[model samples]
Every structure is written in structure tokens, then in C-alpha cells.
Target chain A: MKKDKLVIGGHEFQSRFILGSGKFSLEMTNAVIQNGGVEMATLALRRANVGGEGNILDYMPENITLLPNTSGARTAEEAVRIARLARELGCGDFVKIEVIHDSKYLMPDNYETIKATEILAKEGFIVMPYMYPDLNVARSLESAGAAAIMPLGAPIGSNRGLLTKDFIKMLIDEIDLPIIVDAGIGRPSQACEAMELGVDAVMANTAVATAKDVPLMATAFRLAIEAGRSAYLAGLGRVLESKGEASSPLTGFLQD
Target chain B: METKMDHMVYLDYMEQVDSDIMERVLDTVEQYDYNTYIVEDVKAALCKDKLDIDDFGALLSPAAMPFLEEMAQRAQKETRAHFGNAVSLFTPLYIANYCENNCIYCGFNCKNKIHRGKLSMEEMEKELQSISKTGLRDILLLTGESRHQSDVKYIGEAVKLATKYFALVGIEIYPLNTDEYAFLHECGADYVCVYQETYNTDKYEEMHLSGPKRIYPYRFYAQERALKGGMRGVAFGALLGLGDFRKDAFATGLHAFYVQRKYPQGEISFSPPRLRPFINNAEENPKDVHETQLLQVMLAYRLFMPYAGITISTRERAGFRDNVIGMCATRISAGVKVSVGGHEEEAKGDEQFEISDDRSVAEVLSSIESLGLQPVFLDYIRV
Candidate 1:
């Protein structure tokens, strides 16, 4: 009955498409971002060359809201410093705080992530924690002033596709803020499925980057996101029961 | 460590190289015992006259090739009994191809007429992102021997970049100082693999014509520097077919033995990679070590140092790889491409070397399973 336009930090995105800054060349990334019509894109902060000396930031357009990710920071303090640097480098208030203790799974440390989120949120930063699909941790981060909660579908880079679907759906049903499904999305269908489940937005990197055709894959993902969001807004058709069928049977004509 | 081999020590015993000692080592191995006794007993058995250069020769000789099936069975049993049946897999990420060295066998030789790719910090991130999706956690960062392009800072930056995506990151780049190794270790490098390529000083000089890599002892002592830098593991290897396989294998084994004896806490591994086809008809380079010889070297490594991890790359064919997996081979490279930016389905450009086993990860896993061996990923991680 009502169309929901997802808004993050007072910015409304008609299309619930979030782009990832990794994978493509700067020009290709910019083209994909423009074509996908994504309102927000996530960028990781590391000790990379930030100037025109072969840096990803050099390719970032000023219009798109940059969500600086603490993707490389193993500790909360390093994450905080990276967030500060991103802010100083013109990445507004939004910070995607990711403190991964285990490098293998890239699973966020709930304790350290919450700690970083609290610290960043208190310092006037819009904290959106990229976390595992732990509902309790999501709620805790939300209580700690996280603007949005990003729960992974599976281990980062796994591309296993929504292994945490039940837990993520539970969180979506329970949480009041936005539910952004992030990481472990290998195909466009997975993103569509996430959006169909009423997820506000989906952020992807590997699925597009490692594709045979990245730019084309990005466009396909854009279409999938729109279709999924539109379906969610329109409400899905009611599931049919095995016993129910409407038929006029001549044999049973006098029964009724 | 310096005790000479004694023939008179077994005077009271049957002197034909103590089968009792071999039996003891075999018994310890049979019991899945990996304590000091196993290492000590293996060392003793190897030290016994029974395990002479000729016996070692007998083990790796052409006659030993037929015994491979039996040797592999023994090695596989020992490996399974100790390290389990799963073969550890890892992919190498060549961060920079720029080189100052003029090594004769390499595609990235200083004089080669190929476009070199050196990823910047951002580009390195992009590369890592591309590779991360392949479901590989153990990664090796490689670079050509170029002090200008691949100095310690460059290697360390690559290590940091790799740390963003991988749990276990090893370096096979240019050799660095102990301090540089320490710096890389702090930057999250777990292991360092520096193959001497050839241990014979004269041949090493001849092979590495021009560059810092020409210095034999510097490369020879790289693993020691890495260990001194607090690395958890140091891998030693000789590029088979670089020189005489026998001499190289002997030197490589001795080097590993010395390193293991010195750094008992550190993990030691050996790789016997034969020179594959490269650009400019470099494949025509002499001293091509055959598959049988390669198997001999692998079996010898296992028989000599059973605990050491033996790695076989995709340079060998699929059948050879399959045959060797249950043998002394403890690790393998599957779906491997030696080219830069090769993770994408299509090759972006010319590859460094054509991969022999062009199977995908899934196919490799199924193959491993078909052999009645379990395919395991993330075997060491807790979660």
C-alpha cells in the first residue's frame, strides 16, 4: 500500500543500491556508481597513496556520499584513527566501522566493533557498523548510536550467499533502523533476494569486481535491486496452499 | 649437530645400516608419534649408514621411481597420521613484476620485453579484492628481484594490503635485511619463502647474471633473516632444473635440515618446482628436470624429513599432481595462473607461465574427494 524510500543519514535514495569502492578501476568504478544510481558507496581507508599517485580516492566523485570503511583495521583504535583520517579527507560524518579480529572470516569483533561505534558516534560521527548476523550485537550497536546496521550474509568474500538468512530476517523484523545486507553476495540474485526480504539496501564488491564483465554486472545488479525493492513495495503474491483449487466439476455439480 | 657418521658405532649390531633404527623410526611413525622422538629418530635413521648418500640416492634414483607407489603410500600414511589427509592450498599474488635482476630463467628478468605491472597501494587493494573472492585465505606475495621497485617498504605495503584479505600471508619477494624482515613481520607477514634457485655458488651466479639476487650467500641466508625477524615459518626450496637436480636437492635438503635444527620452533617446508615453459624460448634452457626426478626429490624430502611440508605447483601436469598428492606432497596449488591479475575468468594479458593443472577450485576439490581424500578449507582456524 505504501512505497518505502530508504534514507540513510537524512539522504533519501530512491534506489536502495549501495556500491562498493573496491574492484574496478577508478573510472570504471565511477561509471558503475553513476549508472547504478547508488546514493552511497563504501570506501576502505588504509595506508595507501591518497593523492593523485594511483589512489582510489582520486577517482571518487564528490557527489556520492562516501562511507569510509575500517576494512583493514584489526583493532578499535586503528579503526578510530582511520575514521578520523577519512573525515579529515572530506569523507563527511558517516563511518562504516569494521573491526575484524579474525582475518580469515573477516568477521567483525562484536565487542571491539561496538566499542569503536560508541567512540565514533560520541565524536559526532554517523556510525554504521558492518557486523556479523548476530541480532544481539546489532541491537547493541544500534543502542550505541549506530545509524544503520550491516549484517553479513556469510563470511566476507565467501560468496556463499545468505547463509545467515534466518538470523538476518529475524533482525530485520526486530530492528527499527535500516538493515543493510553486506558482503558474501556472489550473484545478483542474492542481492535481489535480500531486497525482497525488506532489506533497505545491499552493498557488494566481489560479485561485481571479479565478474567477467564488471560494468555489465554492475548494471545487472542495479536492475536486480530495483526489481527486488519494487516487489517488496508492491507486496508479494500470496503463497498457495496444496489443498486449495477453484474448479467447476460436473461430477460434483449437485453436491452444493 | 656436528657428529660424524660412525660405522663402528654399529659394530656390535648388524652393521648394514641399522634396520632396528629404521624400524624404530618406522615404529614411531606408525604410532603417529610427532614428539622429539620422531624427529630424533628420523634424524638418527638418516644419520645411520643405512641412510647413506647412496641409500638417499637409492631412494630418489630411477629405480626408486617404481617404489614411488610404495613410497607415496608410506608418505601418505605418515602425512595422514601426522598432518591429516587434507592438502593445504594457497595462491601467490605477484604484486610487482619490475625487476633489477637479470636471471636467465625468469619471465620477469630485467631484460625481458614485457609490460611490467606494479600495483600501487590502491591497485594492490584492488588486486586483493579481486583475489579475496576466490575463497583463499593463505596467500603468498611475490615480486621480481628489484630493489628499486620492490624494496622493503614496497613488500611491507603489499603485506599490509594482503593482511586486509588473508589470514596467512607469505613473502617470496626480494630478500631483505633482518630489520626489514622484522618490519614486514610487524606489518603482518607470517612466512617468507626465498628459494636459492640454485645453491651452487658458481651456478647461482651464472643463473642470476645481474642483480642483487646474484649474491649467493645473501639469498642463502634469507630464511635465517626471516626467522630472526620473528617469522613463524620459513620455506626453503630449490628451483629444480636450474642446475643439477641431485646437487640442488642435496643442498636444499641440507639447508632445510640446518634451519630446522637451528630454529626448532619455526615451521619448515620445501618445494621442488621444476622450470616450466617461459617466454623467449626460455623453456629451451638446459637442465630440464623430469617428472620422475621431481618425484624422486619429493620422496627423498619425505623420507629424509617426514615432518617437512612438500609443495608441488601447477607446473606439473594434472596426472602428476594427482599421483603426488598422496605421496610426499603436503601442499599444492590448484587452478593456478602464474600471470598477474589472473583471477578473472579471462586472462587480462600474457601469463608468466602456463599452468599445467588448469582445474577450478571446485574441480580440484572434487578431484581430491574422488581420490577418497577429504578436501578441507580453513582447517586451522577456529571459526
Candidate 2:
């Protein structure tokens, strides 16, 4: 029942989902990630330890590759610096560039993100730009040499649960790179819906972080993502607009 | 066509109008099938036939209070249907208690010899941290009417400071110009609440003898200014015991009605704060309003503007507040301490006003749940 291989940035992930490292104790976060069966997790560089004993890196499992994120950086320059720091701190090669200019909404600055992605790709880093679900922006990011494109289902930490469904579906249909739906997912059902739309992966924190039971919610998300992916691969049943008669009178009429 | 009556003339005529006319308006509102029809007809019916003061009188009369209960109940059901079974909770954080105003009702009057306290940036942070522990995501920043000590710049800084902890931030400070209001909104203020205190021109002048608040029309038109400033919502309220409750109530409703009509996109809320017992000579306070009357006022507000949010603060008793929540009230202040630096521990020696409902946020949530209503912590998302 578990078909959990997903490819991003030319690297294979045994798990189809990624978890965020914020708003959870290290022990509880580790328990949730381990329980959820995630292969990789994203950690914010701002929240990471700098010459400290108990950094996020110290708590995470050795096998779990750290995908450092530029969460607080609001411009291309700041994001690049954060990415460099993460690379220096041994999180090599890959960076999740989140240059959000809108402080109120935390919406990614598409202009800054593209500019940063171009520079980072030139610098030999596998850059995944967190962008709006706009097809044009996603295509631009891809052209700018981004390894993958992250589109928000809704605003960050809003728990609004897939507000951009139609746009996300369109992005999934159009983009060649892996589409990772990030942010605004409140429940496992939303995650499942995103996965069913054929997004390559989902990254979440607040849904599990703020839940009454974090590890249990993590497991629920894992199961939901698997079920949705399976349903997608097996092909969904056709939806009927109206109920059809059990016996077709038209067939008898045709024979007569 | 309804005759155009001056605001004061209309209020005076309202006292002498017949009760039967009020009954007709109520019946007309009830019999109307469509919401648009009711909205149009109710306003038309009340204002029709030479601005029948009788209908206004009847709607507010004691006889109408019982019938108004039905309207309030309907409004409550609609409020519950739209907003769900939850009371939106928020706390008002008083930044500086220094007032240049000489408003007669307040404890923080400049002339009064009470211990005045103001929080510096560091103190304000401590207050924010203390309030954040209550699990409250909405806050209203309040201040005294000191233009020099606590001006727009000071308030804007406070609003910015508040955004770090709260998802929604509002102000209940002095009125500002449109540009100043816009500046505060840019600093992340979601709402602005400025009570006209009393709308009766003569009483308004007498009560606010000194300070910038004494400027009557300027304060009266502040909500309009706030709307122009790009605020998402504005709250209107009147000090219940300051003047004749009926006249004041009528004016308050009219103010809200005009603003709502003017700014259809903005959200409007109404609060009816009765004068609570102050420290000096509580006995000699001749203008104390009754609880039943307060309930009647709240019920009337709900009946008048069914969509407007009715908020009850900690000025009321726990039993009365508990009862009103199910009736017509939709928002409340819980675990409230009105004094400066109150949340850090027991309020510092100097406090503003005495808070009635002293229950913690957890206790308030449980109490609300016991009444079969859900306690929603976060309802609004920026997206």
C-alpha cells in the first residue's frame, strides 16, 4: 500500500512528503517525523543553531537530509546569504528559497525569488522556489533553473485548507518539475486533495504543530497522502451527473 | 416621503410618538419575506409619514423591549448561523494612562489624583508576552486622551508592537486625521474603536469640558475618518449612563446606520458601556443605569441592526454577561484587567477601572462551552 518514492532536484526521496521544523519541541518533532515516515524535512536557517549545543541539526536523524529554507529573508540578497550559511553549516547543494516580501501575508516575492533562483542555479545549488500557483511564475522559475517549484495552497500558517485548488491543479498539469503544495493546509483531507490533484509532494508544519496530538496527525497525513497517490495512479471512478436506470429501456427500444 | 427632522428634534419627537406606530413597524418587519424587502421597508416604515417619532419611541419603549426580544432572538439565531456558536474574544491593552482630557466619567481624568502609569517599549513587550499566554490572538490598544504624551506616532508604535503577538489589532484611543489613521492601518491596525461617549450636543460639551475630545462634531465624525483611512472595521459605542439612555441609544444606532450605509464594504460593531462604579464616592453617582435597562438596550441594538456585532465588556457582572451572551451578544472580553501592567501578575498598585469578569481564558472557554457554544480562537485569515 506504500508507494513512497518521489524525485525532486534529481534526488530520490523514499518518502513522498516533507515536514517543517517550527512550533514543535525537538523530541516531539522527531517523534512525529519518524512516526509519519517522512524521508526528508525542511528546517529554517534563522531557527537553526549558530555555534550552539542544541541546534535543529543536532536533533534531526542523521539519515534525514536537511532541506534548509529561507523563511525570514524578504529579498534575493537575504535568501542567497541564508542559503550560503546553510551550505556552510553542512546542508549541502539544495536550498528552498522563500523570499516573501509581503510581511502581512507571507506571500513569496515572485520577482525576488526568480532573481535569486537564477543566481543560485548559476552557483551550483539545487534551488526550489516557493512561489504562487501562477503558471507563468512556475514556468519562469523552471526556466531560471529551479530544481522544483513550491506553490502555496493558501497563505503560510493560515490553515485555510486548499484555497488555490483550481490554480494548483493547473500548475500540476502544466509544470514538468515536481509541484510541492506548501502552506495553508489545515487537515489531512486537504493534503489528500492536493495529492489527488497529482502534486508531487506536500510540506506542512502548523497543521501538525498546532494539532492537539502532533504525532497522530503526522501519521494521518502520511496515510492520507498515500491513499490519494494510490487513487491517482489507479485512476479515479467517473462521476455521474445524474442517476442512471438499472435496466436500460433504450437498449430494448434499439433491439425492437 | 418621510419628513426630514433635525437630529435633536427627531430625538425629542421620539419621546412623544405613539406606541402603535412602533407595533406596525415591527409587524411590517416580521411579515416581509425577503431580506432586501425587510431592509428597505423597515427603514422606510420607520422613517415614513413625517419621520414618525412614535415608531422610534415605541421601538425603544418598555412595551417594545419584550417584542424586541423576539427580534433579538432572531438576530441571535442569524448571528449564530453566520458566525457559528462562538463568542469572539479580545483584550484591550492600555498602553499609557495619561490623559489631557477632563471627561467626567473616567478614572484616568488628568485632574484626578489617581496613580497614573505608562508602559515603555520594554514594559509593553512584557505586557504583550503576558497577554499572549492567555491564548488570545485579538487585541485592542487603548490610551488616555493625551495628544502630546500618547499621540498617533506613539499609538502606531504600539500597534506595530502588538502585531508580533496578535493576529488582529485595534485601537480605542483618541481620534486622528485620515492620514494619521491610514498610517496606523499601515502599521497593522485592523480596527479602530472611538466611543462618542455621548451624542447629545449639550451633554457632550458639558461632559467633555476640556481637551481635544471636547470638540463635538470632530469626535462625532471620527468613524467616517477611520473608514476613509482604510480600516477594515469600526466600532461605535456610547456611555450608557451619561445622558438619557433612549435618546443616546437612538443617536448611537443612527450613527452606526449612517456609517454602515456610507461604507458598505466596512464592518461595523456597537457597544453599550454603562458607567461602572468608580473609586470616589460610588454612592453619590446619581446617573447609574439599571441592569434590566442595559439588557433592554442590548436587545434593542440587536433588533435594530441584526448584522452588527454587539460586544459586552467586563463592566457587567458575570451572571448578567453569561445571560446576555446567549441573548444577543456576539463578542466579549475575558480574563480582563483594565489597569496598566495588569497581566504580568496581580495588577501593579495603580490600575484603571475594576474588571467584573475575573475568569481566566481557560475558565471563560469552559464556561462558554458549558453553554453549548464553541470557543473559536482564530477565525480570520489574511488570505
Candidate 3:
């Protein structure tokens, strides 16, 4: 387990946890990455300001992978435009496509996601798309050259853990690519349970960023991911309807 | 047509103001006693982990008053959770005040014998430089509802120059058709704000008198058309004193809620601007909405739609603006000027209304920080 690595898009990372930098205090950006032992993270592409708060990249450590998300995109065209602009920022080839149109539900549009992924992946971009869980869509995305399948655990920022557990599990069972459970993961235990269910990794922000102490929560999540992966590797025992026989049974008449 | 009003009345019951715009909708909305919403079904709704529109009437009722502080606390917590400790800042630089309407209670009424002027293209550019130099990136380009001078093309040119210095540009001007809004967007405007003024159409028609703005449905649908035209966001509001403030707040919230459902992709914000006094205005005695009531309405807005932006401007004083910045509202307009060519040069023309808070952007920033909050001057990026 110590030697294990989570691989995606031909890149290998020892930590399965990926930090989302939205809604987090700028000062905590470095801590969330360094102390949490996170090897990758996501940030949105905003217009470069000459001064003021500066860039999210300014706070990032030198050696971690950057997965810039197209968060404000509502259509494939918009998402593609963001992806191209992000590439121009020299953040490497990785892009996280989040094409969401339903503001009421805040659900990702899988059709547009696939369209954007197809266009982006062909243009030498490593595409990892966030989507609602669907096997057909996963297959479509895989054919479209997406590097990984990221299915939401629930709505974004909901903190309602694992409402889509079975759907995520279904993807893990059928989808040939790595199934990363993203969004709505509220607690550390929820992350542990996700790993125990054979998920490749869990990606979340609100679960830690909204906590009373962000860096502490980030540490808890790090340990939880490690524990879940170890338990999965150790092979948990099966459940039974009835209890097993005692070491000294009542059938021993003298003892009874 | 003039009467010394003692208390506000139902639009149907009023004989002085024109009741045509409100007649059909009044019967439907008047049935509910929203005054008791707090103690009735709304309390239960607010107690729940999540609230729906069914709880709207209860929150607006008189019963909701005792729970104002509680609602404010919740509003503060959720707003922080959603938008963070920052308040996105912008300042309106009025480019024109050449309105052509004969409203009874307005500073810019056609008969009011005041200066009518629009900023020349060069004047607008100079104003942009003046505003951009303030280090405020979000700019709102405003115009009088004039078709001839501040037409779509005129506003369009202003937007092009504004894109040079500002990352986010919004407009609060005459309502236009869908394609015209799209043209404005293509020309570099990112958002549009149109105030319905009063949801009670009768009061609105009586107030507006005669103009293209008299068409109620066109103004009502302007935000929707802006979204269709590909603007990233649109803001909604109503002038608070024209009708029952409670009822106006309720209608404004419901309108924004409906718009959110319709254009799920567009950002929604609500601004309930109070009626203020202007020099030479004939009707000076507009109804007063206490600061407490304004706070209550702001809390209700946060509870009903947690994600939408609540904006407070210079119409309210510095103290009220400071009190609400971190507590409920997520957006504020600082260093506002309400006259043509007000920013760049001598502001000699008649201002639409006198600004109560004359604080600069630095003043607003320091005040926001004194409350342990970060003042965010920018949120959206053009890339």
C-alpha cells in the first residue's frame, strides 16, 4: 500500500486526494496543499489582474499538478473557450471540464461535457470531466478521449454525502477508466467509505474548506483517504446473518 | 389626483394613483395575509434545513418581525458560506441624465426645467480613466432612458472603451429588445440591471407618466432578454417607497426566483433602492422606510435565495452600508455619481438624486475590514 500510486492521464500521484481551491482563504492555499500532502489541485481561470489579490498560481507550490476547471461555462463553446484560454496561461495540458447549465440543480451537462472534452482532448489537452453518473456517458467520454471519469457524489457544495453512492459504484463496476468520485463529500468518514467501495479517489472542497479549522480538516481528510485505501487493500471480512459459535460453547455440559 | 396619504393602501383601494397595471394581478396576490407569515407556515419553513418558495408568504408576514435578528444571523452565516468574506465592489458612473418623461415625483421629469445632457464620447473615456484609476475594476455604465442620445449604439461605444480598464462591466439603462441586449454583450457589456421600480404596475404607470418605459411587460422582461442575449448575469430590483415595502420586497424576491428558474445559467441579484429626494423635485415627501425595515428585507432576501447577490448603494448612508455589508448584502456600489459627466470633470449638472454617503472606495474598504471581512473588488474574469 505504501508503494501504491494513483495514475491518471499518464501522470502518477502518490496522494489520491485532489484539493479544490475555491471558497478557501488565500492564506490557506499553500497549507491545504502542503500539509494535506495533496499532489494535485484545481483552480478556476480568471482574468489576470495587474495588482490586488494576485493569481491563484502565486500561492501554489512549485511541483504540484494544476487542473484548472471551467467552472463558469454553461455550454460546450464556452467550456472550450475557457480551456483554450487556460492552456494559454501555461498551466500545462491538464483541464477540468465542468459544463453546468442547470443553475437550480447545479448539475453538470454531460452532453456538453463530452463535446468539450472531444474538442479539447484532440487539441493536445488532458481532459478530466466532472459529470453526473451515467455508464453510457462514461463510455462516450472515454471514446471522446477523456483521461478520467469524474462522477459527482451529489450536487456541488451540497455537503450531502453519498446520495449518489450506488450510481458511483455502478460506474466503478462498469466503466473501464478510473472512476473518481467528485463533489458533495461532506465528512472524512464519507471519503473513507468511498474508497472502501472501490472508488479510485475522492475529490472535494466544501468538506474541508467550510470546516471550523481548514488545515486541520485537510489533515483529517488525508488520513481518512489513507485509511480507506489501506482497508480496501487489506480485504474487509464478509457480513453474516447469525453470530459465530463461541470459543467455549454452552454445549460443554460441565461448564454450563 | 393629489392626496395627503395617511397610510399606504391596497392599489385597488387607492383612487389617486392609476390602478390599471395592478388590477389583474392584485386579486391573486392579495388573498394571502403575508403580514402573519412568520408565525404561520414560514417559521416551520425557515426551521427546516432547506427552504422553498412555499415559505415565502410566511417570511413576509408581520409575524416575521420578532424573528428579524434570528433571520439576520442565518443570513450572515449562509452568505459567508456561499460568497465568502468578500463583498464585490462596483461604482456607477452616470454618463447621461437626459430623460424624456413627465413623471410627477422625479428629479428628471421633462417639465422640471433642468439641464439635459449626455457625456460626449471623449468625456465618457475620460470618466472611465478617472474611475479605473480608483483601482475599482467592476464598472456599471448608466444612462438616462433616452432613445435619441443614449441609444444602443451610444451605450455600445461606451462599453467598448470600458472593456479596456474594467474586467466586469454592467449597465442600468433603458430596456432594449433581446437582439439589442445581445449587441451590447458582443460590444463588451457583461451584465444588465433593470429595476421594475414598483411591482404594483398601477403605481408604476402613474409614476412613469409617458415614455417608452411605460410599457410594463417590456421592462419586466428586460432581464430575461439580457440573458438570452448572452449576458453573463442580470440584476433585478424595485424602488422601495412607491408601494408597500413588504409587498414590494416579496414581489421582487418572487420575480428573481422565477428568473433564476428560467435562466438557470445566469447570475441573479436583487437591489431594493429606496426613494430619495432631489433638488427641484415637486413631490419631496416620499414615504420613509426605516433602516430596520431595510435590514429585515435584506435578511428575507438572503433566506429565500441564498445564492443571489444583495446590493446596497450610496442611496443609503455610510453607517447603514457598513452595517449590512458583512451581515447580509454581498455587493455594494461605492463612490457613486448620479449626474452626467460627474466623474471626470466639474459635476455642475443636476444630479438625479443627492448621494447620502460620500465615502470613497478606500473608505468603504477600510470600513468593511474593520468588521473582520475582506472587501472583494473583483469576482468575474473575462477569460
RMSD in angstroms, all models?
16.4, 11.4, 5.8
Error of 3 at B268 (Å): 1.5
Model 3 misplaced stretches (Cα beyond 4 Å): A47-54, A240-256, B1-28, B36-38, B281-288, B366-375, B381-383
- Measured with C-alpha atoms, the lDDT of residue A27 in candidate 3 is 62
Summarize candidate 2's per-residue lDDT along B1-383 as a digit string, tens digits: 64322223222111121123223322443332221233333444344322233343445555554454454555555454323345677788888788888777778877877777677777888889888777787788988778788878888888999988877798998878788889999999978898987766778767876766776656666777887888778898889888877667766776776677667656778888988767653653527468777876776676566557788989887888877775678788887878866788444325556677888877877777676554545433231
Which prediction has the highest DockQ against the true structure? Answer: 3
Show the colliding residue pairs in model 3: B34-B61, B35-B61, B35-B62, B37-B58, B37-B61
* Model 2 ranges off by over 4 Å: A1-256, B1-57, B284-288, B345-349
The DockQ figures for the candidates are: 0.01, 0.04, 0.38
Better of 1 and 2 by DockQ: 2
- lDDT value for candidate 2? 0.73
- All candidates' TM-scores? 0.52, 0.55, 0.89
* Interface RMSD, prediction 2: 12.7
Worst 10 residues of 1 chain A by lDDT: A46-55
What DockQ does candidate 1 score?
Answer: 0.01
lDDT of each: 0.71, 0.73, 0.79
